[model samples]
Target: MPNIPRNALRSLTLLVIWEMWKERNARVFRQYGRPATEIVDSIKGEALLWIKAGDTALANLLVRE
Candidate 1:
């Protein structure tokens, strides 16, 4: 696989983390009034669902292991 620059990877990681944080904060602030722990749990659950969906798609493709 091609290499990624350390700084570029770090920046991308930070951007993803920030986006997730903002999304959780917005959802809690607007509708749920939930605590930080609960908000993080919700984000985790959502991410799990996304992973499951992707896994399902790849399985359907039957790509070589």
Candidate 2:
């Protein structure tokens, strides 16, 4: 929680929740599941998409120091 903007934090929280939900559904319905590392990678990839879509607050929060 590195002093991220509220919007950025909200976006991240929702992203995590959505991903977890999808994983749960996949496991329960499709008998498929991904490792936690893969889930984190998916989140990173999706964050890049958000950045491309002009979410500067998210971009700032994600940037390496």
Best by the TM-score measure: 2
Question: Please, what is the whole-model Cα lDDT of each candidate in the order they appear?
Answer: 0.53, 0.86
CA lDDT, candidate 1, residue 35: 73
TM-score of each: 0.44, 0.86
Off by over 4 Å in 2: none
What is the C-alpha lDDT profile of model 1 across 3-65, one tens digit per residue? 544543454355458657777687888764567786567655554454466644323322223
* Positional deviation of residue 6's Cα in model 2 after best superposition, in angstroms: 0.8
Give lDDT: candidate 2, residue 40.
Answer: 95
User: How many residue pairs clash in model 1?
Assistant: 0
- Give the winner by lDDT: 2
User: Clashing residue pairs in candidate 2, if any?
Assistant: none
Candidate 2 C-alpha lDDT tens digits along 8-59: 7888888889889988999999999999999999988888898899988878
